[model samples]
Target chain A: MNGIGAAMRDAAEGVDVRAGFTGDVLRGGRRRQVRRRNGIALALAAVVGVLGFGAGMAMRDVPPVSDERLLAATKGDLADDREVLLTATVAWRAELTPSWTRDRGVTELRGEPHVYWASTTPVGDAAVVMQEGKVREQWRTLVGLVARDPADGFPKVVGTTNPEDPTAGTESFQFGPGDRTFLVVDPGIPVYASPNATRNPAGVVRRTWHEVPVVDGVGVWTAPDGVAPSTVRLVTSIGPPISDIPAERLLTTRPASAYLRSGVHAKRNGAPAYDTRMWNNTSRKQLRVGPDGPAPSPDSDLFQALEDAHMTDIGPPGNTGTWCVYGTSGTGGGLLVGEYADGDEPSTLFALLFRADGTLDRVQRGPAVDFGSPLPVRVRLPDGQGWVVASSQYLGIAYRTSDPGDWQEAQTGSQAALLPDAAVQVRVGSGTGEVVVDLPR
Target chain B: MAVHAAEEDFEEFVVLRSQSLLRTAFLLCGGDRGAAEDLLQEVLERMFVRWRRIKGPPEPYARAALANASANRWRRRSRKPEADWELAGTPSVCGHEEQVVDQDAVLRALAELPPKMRAVLVLRYFDDLTELQTAAALGCGVGTVKSQTSRGLARMRELVVEVTR
Candidate 1:
C-alpha cells in the first residue's frame, strides 16, 4: 500500500466499528415526515385566507375604519402580532408583482411597492392599494390596485393610474361607485420624476410629480374625468416607507475607505522577477528548488527577514496574493513562501528558513527586477534553505509535489504543499522583486 | 399494506448496515461520536422519507447527503477570519517520540483537513469507492475528485509529519 493509504488504514483500525444506536430511527423518520406535511398544509391554508379576504374586500363595504381600528382588527387580542403583520404584508407585496395582472393587460411595475393598507369590508369585500415608487424611470406618481382574484388566492392588478393627471387619475371598473371606506396613504416624502420616463401603451404619460407636505396629512381628491363628486372620497395619513434604513445600506456594508491606499506608495518598483519552483525528493532525502536549491525548515530567521522587508500579510481580499507552506521530510519544520501584489503597486516576495530550534533565518530582499519581460530568477542554496520571488506580474501558480507526473501542470492561486517527501518544483512569474535566503545546516 | 412492507424493508436495511454507515460518519465528523450519531440519524430519516422511490442501493445517497450537510454546516458556522497569512509565533517541531506512527495521531491529522477534503478521503479510503463512484456521490466531476484526492492526501501527509515529528 502507498504510504498515505497505509497510514490512514492504520489510524482507522481502532475506531469503534459497532453502531451502538439506541434511538428509534424509524420513529424519528416518521415524525419528520409528519412535520413536513403539516408545514405544507399550513402554507396552503394561509394562502387561501389571504385570497378569501381580498375577494371579500372588493365585493362589500366595511364600516369606515380608522388606522387604529384596522390595526386592532388584524392584531386581534395577541400582544405580539408583529409577525402576523409581517407575514400579511409579505403576501400583499407578492400580489403587487407585474405578473399578478399580466393576463389583465397590465405590465408589472419595477421597484418594490409597499402595501400600506389591506382590509375586508363589513360585507366581506376586499380592497387594497399599493404605493409604488416612480414608474418607467420617470419620477411620476403611480399607484397599483390589488384587484380580487378570479380563481386562485393571488391578487391581480386590475389597473394602475398616474395620480397627477386628472384625466387618468382613477380606474373605476374594479370598484363600484358607492359610500366605500377609503384608506388614504400620502408618503409625506417628496417623489421625483424619472428623467427617462416613457409613456406606456395605455396612454398614461409619465410626468414629473412631487407632493408638498401638508400639516393635516389630508389632500384633495381629483376624480377621474366624468366621475361624480359625491362618489369620490379622500382620507389622509402620513405613512413613511416601512423601514427607515435605505435599501442600499442593507445590501452592501463594505466601508468606503477599505481599499484606500496612498497614491505615492502604490507605484510599482521596476525589478527583475523569475518563475521559481521547489520540491523534496523522498528517495534521495533531499529538498530541491528549481535545479539545485534545498528546501528550508520553518524555524529559520528568514521569517523575520520577510517581516523586516515589509512583505508579510500579502494574501487575499486586500491584495491578489498567496502564501503556502509545505512540510519537509525528516524535519518537523515547514517550508513557508508567500507572494502578494496590488494593482500597479510593487509586488513583494518573502521566504523563511526554519530549523528545529524555533529560530527563523530571514532571506534579505533581493535586487528589484525590471518589468515587461518574464525574467528568470534562480537561487542555488544549500540543503535546508529557501527563497521567494515577487513581481507586479507574478502570475500566481501552484504546483503539486505529491504526484511526480503532475508536477508539469500548474494550479492557479496559492496552494499548500502537502507531501513531505515528493519531488516537486514551482514556476512563479516574477514581475516586481525576488528574495533569496540560504541558512547554514 | 404495500407501504407497510416497504417501510419494513427499509428498517431491515438500516439494521443490517447501520454499523458500517456509522463508521463512515464517525470519520467524516472528525471522530466525534455524538456528531456522527446525529448525522447518521438525520441521513436515515431523509432516506426513509423517499424509501419507495429510491432505486438501486441507498448507501451512495446517504453518503452524499452526509457530505453536503457537513459542508453546509461548516460554511454556516465559520465566519471569514482576517486574511493574516503569517504563521504566528515560533513554529514548534513535533517531538521525536511521535515519529513512531501512532494511529490516533494519524486520525487527528486527518480530522484537521477541510470538510470536502476530509469527505473525499473517507469516501475513497473508508468506503473503498473508486474515483468515478466518489465523483457521482459528491455530485461533481471525476476531475474534481482527482484534484481533491491529491490535495487532501498532500495536506494529510503534512499534518502527519507535523504530528509525528
Candidate 2:
C-alpha cells in the first residue's frame, strides 16, 4: 500500500469481465495467422518466378535499352536545355454504378481509365490531361520562386490557367539575383505588375499597371538592373485585377493615418488585404504564450531542437514558432514565443531568445489571459525596429526576421510608425495567424 | 488430437483467469470498457496461437501480451489520451467520495502517460508484479523499469495537482 501502486489498484477494481470471449479471440487469432502465412507463400512464389525467368533469359532474344536513351525519349522537347527535374504520373479510375429502386438493388457498374501528365520545367511547370497521346486540357503558368516544392528541385508554378481551354501566356519569373525574365508561351493570358516602393529608390512607380505586350502573347521586362531581390517589390498578377484601378496605386495613395493603422482588410478568400479593408480594429490584447518559467515539454519542437543539439530541459513547456534573425555583424539567433501548458492546462505566455549557438539567451513570461480572435499586432521596438506579431491561441506567435541580434523590446504602448524598418506581414483573424513572407530567393 | 488438447487447455485457462485479466486490461485502457474487451480478445488470440508451447503458468505471458498490445494500439492509432479517457466517462464518486475522486484523478493521469510508462505502472501496481517480474514481462532491463516507474509516477503526481487545481 504505497503512493501510485495503491491508487492504481483501487482504480483497477469493478471492471466487468464478459463470458465467452475466448472463442472470439481464438477465431480472430486463427484468421490473422492464416493471412500472414498466405502472404509469405505469395512472396516466395514471386521470388521463384524471378529466379526462373533470370535463368531462362539467356536463351531468348530481347533488346536492351540504356537508361540514357530511355530518359532522352521520355523528355521529348525540353531534353537539351532543361534537365529532368522531377516527373510524376497519376493513374485513376472513375466508376459508375446504376442502381434501380423498383426491381433490382443494383443493375450495372462501369469504370473508365483516367490518367494525367505533369512535368516541372526549369522556368515554369505545365500540367495537362492527356487522352490518346493528345493534350486534352493544358495549363501553363509562371510560378513564384517561393512556391516551389523543395522535393522537386525546381521552382513550382503558382496560379493555374483554365485547364479546359489551355491558354498560352507569358509572365515575369524572378530568377537569381533579382534577374527578371518574362516567360512567353504559345497561348497568353493577361499579366499585371506591382512595383516595390521600398526597392524603387526614386519612388518612380506609385501605381500598379497592366503591361501591354510588345508582341502578341509575349512580354519582356527587367528590374531596373542591380536591384536586390529583397529590395525588388514586384508581384506578378496572373488573375484579373482585384480593383478597377491597379492595386499598387490603391495601396500607395492611402492616407498616412490609414497606413499607421494596425489591421488589414479581410479578403473574399479570407486573406488579409492591405488596400481593401479599412484599418478599424485596434484593440491591443495580451495573451499568455508560455509557462512562467523554463519548462519545455519533451514533445515540443523547441525541445526536439534542444535534444538534437544534446541540450535538454532548457526552454518552455510548449512548442512555439521561431525564425532566424540576422544582423549586420553576421551574428544572429532565433526568437521563440508561445503559450506553455502543464498537461491540459495552459498557465502563461513565454518568449525565449536563443543565442547563435542554440543556447538560451533570455526568457520572458506574460500574465495568462483568455485570447480572442488573434488580431495582428505590429510593434516597433525601442531600438527602431518593426515586427508584425501574429498569435495562435494554441501555438503562440510566428516571429521571423533577417537580423535579430540587435532586436530590443519597445516601450509599453509604442506606436507603429516609430518601428518602421522591419515589416513582418501576417494574416490576422485567421485562426492560426499565419505569417506571410516571401521565400528567400 | 494434439490441436484438440491445446484448444482444451487454452479454454480452461481462459475460464479460470479471464476475470482478473479483464480488470488489468480495463486499467491498461484507462477505464475504456470497449477498448479493454478488444485488447483482451487480441491478447487471448495471440496466446491461443502459441498455447501448446506455453509451459508452466500462462499469467505472465498473458499479462505481457496485454501490456504490449495496449502499447501497439496507442502507437498505431495515435489517438489522444485525453480524448480517449474523456470518452470513457468519469467514474461514480458516490460511496467513498474522496477516495473515488482520487482514484479517478489517478486513472486520468495514467491515461496521459506514454504507453511504455503506463504499462510499467499497470504491471507493477495493478497486477502486483515485482520490479524484476515487470522487467521480464516488458522485455526490458530492471533500470528501464525503475526509470519508467519513477517518471510515470512523477508525471501522474503533476497531473493530479493540475486536475485538482
Candidate 3:
C-alpha cells in the first residue's frame, strides 16, 4: 500500500512537471497560429456584415424567459383538448454548416399535426417547427419540423418539407410526418416583448434581452392577433424571487454541424446509436457505439426514446452520464428506456441505473457515454446479460455477455415491453453484453 | 497601448493561453502526444473567433473547450469504434514493474471521474495547482475544489486497486 501511494504520487508529479512545459510550448505555438487565422476571418466577416452589427446588437437585448415564468409555464393548464400555436423568430447562430452570421427566422407551432390539438399550451406530444424563409446562407424554402415530446424532452426531425437542401452531412434527425406528433396540453410563458433600447458606452445603439420578474400573468399577444397567439412583456428591473434575473448565460450559437460533430446528440440506452461515419470533425474520432453496427433509423426506438425527452437532458450531458440498453422479453414486448443521469461520469451513470428499480438489469460495465464536457467519462452498466429498461432514459449497451446476474428483491411487474429491432450486442473494454429487445430487426 | 488593445482582441487571448492550453490538453489526453496535439489544435481554432470574451480565465476556457471537444470525440468514437489504436503494451498492474503499468489505466480512471472531479484532479495533480488555484480556475469555492480533489484521488486509487488486484 505504501509503495502504491508513492508510485501514484510519483506518477502524478511526473505528469505535472512534464505536462507543464510541453503542453505550454506545443499548445502555445499551434494555438497562436489558429487564433491568428480566426482573428483575420472574424475581422473580415465583421466588415462584410457591418450593417448586421447594429441590428444584431439591437437583437441582443431581447428579453429571456424567467425561471418563475418557466415554472409557471410548466404548471399552466390547458384542457385535455385545447392546443395553440407558438411561433417566434429565434435569433441565434445557425447550428448548420458555413455557420450563418446569425439566425433571424420564424418558427411556428400548431398542435402536433394529424392529432387533434386545441390550445397552444405546451404538453406531452406538442410539436412546433421552424418555417421556411431565407436563412442567411442556404434557403429553407418550406417548413422544417423540429418536434419535441416535452413529456420525455426528446426531439426528433419530423421531415423537411422545405426545398433548399439545408442540413446535409449533419447528423440528421427524422420525425415521421405523424411519428413525432406532440400534444400541447398546457399554457407556457407568453412570448416576451421588448420594452425599449439603451445606448452603449460607445454611443452605439444597444439593447438587452430583459424579462420582468413578475409572477404568473399573461400579456396580450400582438404579433399574430389574426392567428391564435399568446404574448407577454417582462422587465429585468424587478430582480430575484419573482423571475430569473438576467445574467450572461451561454446560449449555443454555433452551426448545427459543429454541434452534431461533438456527439452531444449521440448515444442512447447506454449503447452507441450513431456510428463514427456520422462524425463530421475528421480531426477527432467519433464515439464508438457497439462494434460495426447498422445506422440509427427513424423507426429506431432509441431515437424514439430520445425524441420522448425534447432532445434536451435535464442538465448538461457532462454532469450525468446516461445509461441505456435494449432488451427482449419472452412475451415479445421490448423496453426502450433505462436509468438516465444528469452528471458526466460512469459512477453517476451506474448509480442512476441501479437506483432500486432494477430496470438496469445488467451488472456489467457498459460503454462510456461522453457528454461534451471536461474529460471523457465511461458510462458503466451493471453486470448481466440482456438487460432492459422500462424507460428510455436508462437504455445502455453493455459489452457482450448475456448472463442474468443475481436478481435483487425488487418490484417485478409485467416485464417491460422490448423493441425487437433495437436489440443488439454491445462490447466495452473487452466485455460484451447482450441487448435483447422485441422490436423487429 | 498596443498591448492593451491586443489584450482586448480575441486573437491575442488565444495566443496567450496557447501553451498553457496545450499543457492542459496533454494532461487530458493521457500524455498521448498525437491526440494531445490534435486536441490542442481543435480548441485553439474554436477559441480563435471568440477570443475577445470567453468570460472566465483564458486557461479555464481553454481547458473547458478541450474537455468538451475530447468528450465529444469519445462520444462519436464510442458510437462508431473506428479509430485505430496500436497496442502500446500490456495493462500495467499495481506494484508491478513501472514499465508494465498501463498509463491508459490511470488516464481511464481519471477520465472516469465526474467531469468536475476530473477537472479538479487534473488541475491539482496534473497541473500541480494549489487547491485555491484549482478553485479559481474552475470558478468555484475552495471547499468545492477540496472535496472534488479528495473524491477524485480516492476514485483513482480505487481503479488502481481494482485493476492491479
Candidate 4:
C-alpha cells in the first residue's frame, strides 16, 4: 500500500516536472520589469522614514488629563442593577432543562437554560432542549415530547406536528428558563400571558410572561440561583452586542477580539451573510462562565463532512492562538451545515458528501469532536439521509441511524468517518422521512 | 510606486509553485488543467503588480491570491455554460503515459465532487497544503476545513473506486 501511495506521488511529481517547463515561459517576460521597479522602491522608503522622523520632532504634545478630573466630570447619582430578560436571538436560543439531583427529602431540581446554537434547522416548529451537560435532546416546543421513538437506540426529543391543536396537552408545562441552570427572572408567577389563554396547537409556542408588567417584550426575573441572570446571555450572528443591550445589568459580552477580527460570518437562518464564512463568535467569558460544555454534541457527520472537505483549520500559523477542532462519525441527509467561530474553543463544522448521482454518502468533521469523549445528542440532516450522534461519556460511539422508528447504533470505538467503509444509512421514506427535506447541510 | 523582483527569483518561485497552483486551478475548473492554468496565471500576474504587499515568505500570499482567484472563478464559471469547448483541448495529466487507463474516468470523477469539496482536495492533497494552510487559504474556520477535507476525501475514494473498477 505504501509502495502504491509512493507510485502515485511519483506520478504526481512528474506532472510538477512537466508544469515546470511552461512555467519558465510564463515568467520570462514579467521578471525584468519587476526587478527594476523593486530596486527603486526600497531606496524611496528609507528616505521617507528619515524625513518623517524630522517632521515629528517639530510637533507639540498636549498633557494627559488627570484621573481625578476625569472621574469628577463623569460622576453620576446612583448605581443601576436592574435585571432585564435576555432575549437571545434565534441563533443562540435553546430550551434548557435543569438536572435533577437527589438529596435528603427535598429534591434539588435545577433547570438549566441551555443556550447553544444548532447547525440543523427545525422542522414544523422544533426546539432543542438541553438537560445533562452534553445531552442535547429535541423537544417539540408545544407538547415538549422527545421526537425519537424509544425503540431507536437513541430517542431524540422531537416537536409535535398537530396543526389544529399544537398545545392540546401542554397546558401545565412550565415555560420559564432552567430545568438546574441559572436564568435572570423577577420574583413572580411564571404565568401564561398570551392574548388567548386557550392551549396552543401541538407545535405552536405562545410566550408566557413570567414577570407581570411587560416592558418591550421582556420582563425582569429573579432567576433560580443555579440559573443566574448573569449567566443568561444571548448569542448573535453578528456576535456580542455591538452596543449595550437595552438593560443595564446585561452588559454586552465581547467575543475573542481575534475572532471578531478574523471575520467569521454571522449566519441568519443558516445562510451566510455577504462577507463572512460562518457566524460563530462567542465571548470567551460566556463560554467559561457556563458550567457545562456545548449542550448538544452536534452531529459528528456534519463535522466529519467538513473535515474531509478540507474545511478544518489547523492551529494558528505557529500555535500562537487558540485552536479548536470538532468531528462526526455518521450522518443523515438533512443538515444546514456551515462554519462558526467563538473566541474560545473551536467548533467542528461538518457537511455531507454527495455521490456523483446526488446521493448522500457520508459526513465530515474536523479535529473538534476528538477533543470531547462522546456526545449523547444525534443530528438528523434536513434531508433525512442518516443519523449521527456522539458522547465522550459513552464507552463507545453514542449515536444510532435510520428513520425515526428504527435506528441502529454505530460500532463502538469509532467516532469519526475516517475510512470509506464507515458510511451509515439514513432511512428516509414515508413516516419520518417525508418530514425531512433535502436541503444544504 | 510600482513593485518588482529579480527575474531569477521570480522564475524560482514560479517553478517551485506552478504545479501546486495548477492542481488548485484544476479543481477550480472542475478538473480542467488549461482553465486552471489560465486562472493561476491571472493570479501570478496580479501578484507581480502587488508583490510588495507580500512582505513575508511570498508562498502563503501567493497561495491565498490563487485560492481567492480560483474560488471567484469557480463562482463566475458556474453561472455560465458547463464547459467551454476550448477548455476541452487542455490536458489532464502533463505526462503522456501509454499505460494510464481511464483518463476520462478521472476527469468525470473530479467533476463529480462538490464545489467546496473539490476546492479542499485541490488545495490539500493536490496542492500539498497542510490543514491550517488550506483553511487560511479558504478563509474558513479550522473546523470547516476539516469537514470539507473529510467530505472531499470520502467522495474521492468512492469516485476512485467507481472509476478504476
Candidate 5:
C-alpha cells in the first residue's frame, strides 16, 4: 500500500475489540491494586511487629523510654534501615543540651529522647528520633533529626519537624548542607518540590511539581552540585499551597538569592517597549528582571491563534505581559510563555506565537498561577518537541553539574525552557533557589 | 484519594484509552489480536494498581510500560522459539486484492522479526511517535531505535518480496 503506517493502521483497525474488554481490564487492574495495597500494609505490619516485640522486651527490663514515647516516635513510614540495638545513652539528661530548651516561652522539650528511625544516609548516620515535649501545656509532639555535625563528627540534632505550635499541620524537617539530604514529613501531607515564586494575575508564572518520595519518614532527594535547595510545597486541596521546607540549607550546598524582577518591557527597533496592558506596573515594580522580550501584544493577534491551537481562551483583555518567539524552525513557531517579577501585585503572564516577519500568530493569557490550586498551566509545543516552564525569575536548565552539562539560560520572556528528552538531571531554577531535580524517566 | 474516586479514575482511563492501546499491542505482536488484547489487559491492570500514585495522565506511563513489558515477554518466550514462516515457500497472491495482499504480506514480515525490532517499528511508524518518543517507550537509545527501524523496514521489504513471488 500506501505506506507501512497505512498498512499498520488498516490492519489494527480491522482487529475487532472483544466485548467487555474494558471491564476485564478494570477488574484485573483492581485485583492488582488490592494486591499491592495489601503488600504495603503487610510490609508496614512486619516492621511494626518487630518493633513492638523489641519495645515489649525493653519495657520488661529497665524501660528506657516510656511505652507512649516509644510508640509515638516510631510512627510514619515504618521502614527501617536495619534493625539495630539501641545504644541508649546512660541516664535521661541532656547529652549536649538541645538548643530549643532555653529559648521557648511556653513548652520545653521534656522526657528522654527516643531514636526510632536511624539509618545511614549518603552523609552519615541520620535518624528520625523524637523526644516528648509540651507545647503551651498540651503534650504536643516534637520530631527531630539526628545526624553527624559534619563540622566535628559529633552526632547532634540538625533540625526538627517545625510546628512547635499548639496544633500541627503537616510539619516537615529537611536535613541538608551537603551533596545529598534527607527529609521527614508528618504523614498526612502531600508534598512536591516546586519553583520559588510566580508573579500573580497580571504577570503569572507556571509553577512545576515533582512528587517528593518519602522513605522511612524522610524525603529522599539530593541537590546536585552548585545548585540551591529546591522549594517544596505542601499542596492543600482548597487553597494556596503552603510553601514548606524553606531554602535555609540543603545539600544544594550553597544558598541562592531571589534575583527575579522585571516589569513588562520589550525590545522594539533595538529599544525598549512595554506591555501597557491592565495594571501595567513593570516599569516601577520589577525586581531586577521581567516581561522584557516581545513587547506589548495586540490581543486579537494571539486570540484566534491560541483558540485554533487549543491552547487558551484568548478573549478580550485579562492577563497582560511580554512575549517572545523561540525555536523558529518548529511548525508555526516556538512556545510563547511569559512571566512576571517576584511581586504580589496584580500582574499577568502570557504566551504568544508570532511569525518570523514579526507578525502575531497566537496569544494566551490567564490568572497564571493559583498557588494553592492543583491545576497546572501547561502548553504542549506542537509536534511533541517539548513543553514550557514559566516562573517569576529567569531560569537556567541543564543536566546536572554533578553529572555533566552547563546551565543554559531559559528563553527571554517565556521564562521557559524546552528540556531535551535525554536529560537525566535537569537543573531548572534561578535566584528563586535552583533545584537540581531528577527528570523522572 | 478515597477508594471510590481512585476506582472511578482508573475505570475512566481504561474505558477511554484501552481500545487504542489494544491496537498498538496488536501491531507489536504482528497482528495477533488475541495476544494484543491480553497484553493490553495486563498493562492496564498494572496501571490501575498504581492509579493514584501516577501523576497527571497515565498514557505516557502506560505506553512505556507496554513497550518494555512486551519486549520482556518476547524475550522470555524466545527461549522455546515459535514456528517461523517457511521462507522457501511462496503462497499465491492472485485472488486477493493488491492492497490486501500487501497488508497481509507486510504483517507476516513483521511477525518474522525479533520482538524488540518489531516493537521499535510499531512505536515509530504505526504509533507515529518521534524517534525520541520511540526510544523512550522502549527504554533504548535513539541510535538503537534508528537502527532497528531501518533494519526492520529492510527485512520487511525482503520478506514481502519473497512472499509475493
Candidate 6:
C-alpha cells in the first residue's frame, strides 16, 4: 500500500459494531418501503384524478393558456385542448407531477396530455402537450410532446423539464433519442434554426436565425431526423439580429467557431473572458479577428502556464491540458493565454502571458463569479495584446458593458477569444452602461 | 417471493460490507464512531429501500450514497479549524519509531480536513477506488476527484507535521 492508503487503513481500524445493528437496518428498510409506497400511492391517486378530470371534460371548449403559464408547464401540445389545459392547470396547482415529469412515463399518463399544437414533421405526428407540474418545489413547465409514430399507434414523450432558473423563460430540451429536441420560451419569443450556421470572413459564426414563431412559448419544427439544439437561436425577426437572452440561454450562445482574433479579454487578477459560444450567437453576433500579433497555431504555448500551474483538470471536460489559443500577443514574442479554474481554494480566471521559453512571463488571477458585480470583466493583456473581456454571470446577458458601444454579452458559460488590436480597450456595454475592464499598466 | 429475495440479498450485502463501510464512514466523519454508525445506518437503510432499483453492484451505490450524504451533511458547525498544510510540510516516515509516530500523526491530521476532502482521500487510498470510481462514488467529476486527492494528500501531510510537532 502507498503511504495514503496504508495510513488510511490504520486510521480506519478498530471500529466496534453492535450485534443488533443488522436487525435495526432491516427494520428501517420496512419503514422506508412503507414511506415509498405511500408516496407513490399518493402520487398515483393524484395523477389518476387529474387524468379523469382531463378525460371527463374532453369536449369542453377552453381558452388559451396564458403566455406566462406555458413557461412553467411540464408538457406541450401541437393543438390546444381546453380540457387538457384545465387538467394540466389542476395538476400544476395541486403539485401532482404526472408520469410525464417522472422519467419518460409518457406512456403512463393514462392518455395523451393536453394537446396544444400538432404538426406532421419528418419526425412524425408531433403533438406538443402542455404538461404542467410543480416538481420538487420548482415549477417545471416541460416543453414536451407525444409523438405518435405513423407506423405504430404508440405515443412517445419528447423534451424535458423547464429551465431550473425561474427567470430563464426560454430553454432547449432534448427528449428524443440522440439530440432530437424541442424548445420552451416565453410567448412571442422569436426563435430560429440555422440548418448550417457558418462563420463569416469576420471570424464570427453567423447564423441566419430563420424565425420560428413560438405560440405560448413552445415551438416545434421539421428537420431530417436528428436536429441539434445548438443550431437553434431565439432572436429578433427583423433585419439586424438583436441580442437575444433566450438565444444566449440556448444553453449555447453561438457555435464554438467564434475565435476573437484580436486582444485577450484578460485581467491582471486572473479574471477570464473565455466565452466563444455566447459572443457569436447574439445580434452583436460577431467579433473581428483584429490586426494584431501572429495567428495562434494549435501548438501554441497558451497552456504552457496552465502546465506550469499544474491545472491537471483544465476545463469543463474536453478543455484540459490543451491549447485553445485565442488572440495574438502584441509583443509578438510572447503568447497571451486565458484559462478558467474553479476550486475550493479559489474560483478564478487566469490571464497567463507565457514567455518564448514557456515560462509564465506574467500571470494574474481574475475575480471569480461575483453575483453582486454585474459588469463584464475586460482588461488589457500584458504588453498591449488585444484586451480580454468576458461576463461570468450564469443567467443574465451582460449585453452592454460599462461603455455603451456594441454590447459585450454577459455569459455564465465559458469562452476563449483572441482579439484584433484596432481598439485601445473594450468598451463593454451592458444595462449598467459602459463599464471598462481597466487596462492594467 | 421476489421482495423477500431482494430483502435477503440486501441483508447479506449489509452484513458483508457494514464493517468496511463503517470504517469509511468513520474516517469520513473524522474518526467519530458515533457519527459513522449513524451515517452508515442511514445510508444502508436508504440502500435497503433502493436496493432493487440499484443496478449492478450495490456496494458502489451504497458507497456513493454514503460519500454523497457525508459530503452533503458536512456543514460549518461540523468543520474543524483549518490545518496549516504549508507549515506541516512533507512527512518522512522511515524508522519504526518515526513510522509509528507518523501513523498516529496522520490519523489526527486526517480528522482535521474538510469532510469532502477527507472522504476523497479515504475513498482513493483506503478503498482503492480509481479516480473515476471515486468521482462516481462522490457524485462529482473525475477532475474534482483528482484535484481533491492532490489537495487532500498535501493537506494531510501538512497536518501530519502539525500533529507530530
Tens-digit lDDT string for candidate 6 (B13-122): 88888988888887676665666788899999888888888998988777778877887777645555332333232222334776656656766777677778988988
Each model's DockQ score: 0.14, 0.24, 0.02, 0.04, 0.22, 0.21
Q: Any runs in candidate 2 off by more than 4 Å, and if so which?
A: A1-3, A37-441, B92-94
Candidate 3 structure quality by residue, lDDT tens digits, A157-267? 232232222222111122222222111111233223332223233212233443322122322112112311111112223222122323222111111222223323323
Instruction: Please state the error at residue A348 of candidate 6 in Å.
Output: 91
Instruction: Compose the digit string of candidate 6's lDDT tens values, residues A314-375.
Output: 11111222223344455554444334432112233456564545444655544442323433
Model 6 local distance difference test score: 0.50
| Comparing 2 and 5 on lDDT, the stronger one | 5
Question: Largest TM-score belongs to which candidate?
Answer: 5
Superposed on all Cα atoms, the candidates' RMSDs to the truth, in angstroms, are: 30.4, 25.1, 26.9, 30.0, 26.9, 23.5
Which is superior by TM-score, 5 or 6?
5
DockQ of 3: 0.02
Ranking by lDDT: 5, 6, 2, 1, 4, 3
Question: Positional deviation of A127 in candidate 4, in angstroms?
Answer: 74
On residues A104-209, what C-alpha lDDT tens digit does candidate 2 reach at each position?
1212111111112233334344322211111222212211111233333333222221212211111233332223333322133444443332213311113344
The clash count of every prediction, one per candidate, is 51, 22, 131, 111, 23, 69
Most accurate candidate by lDDT: 5
Which window of ten consecutive residues has the lowest lDDT sum in model 5 chain A?
Answer: A255-264
Give the candidate order by descending TM-score.
5, 2, 6, 1, 4, 3
Off by over 4 Å in 1: A1-6, A14-22, A47-441, B79-101
Which docking class does model 1 fall in? incorrect
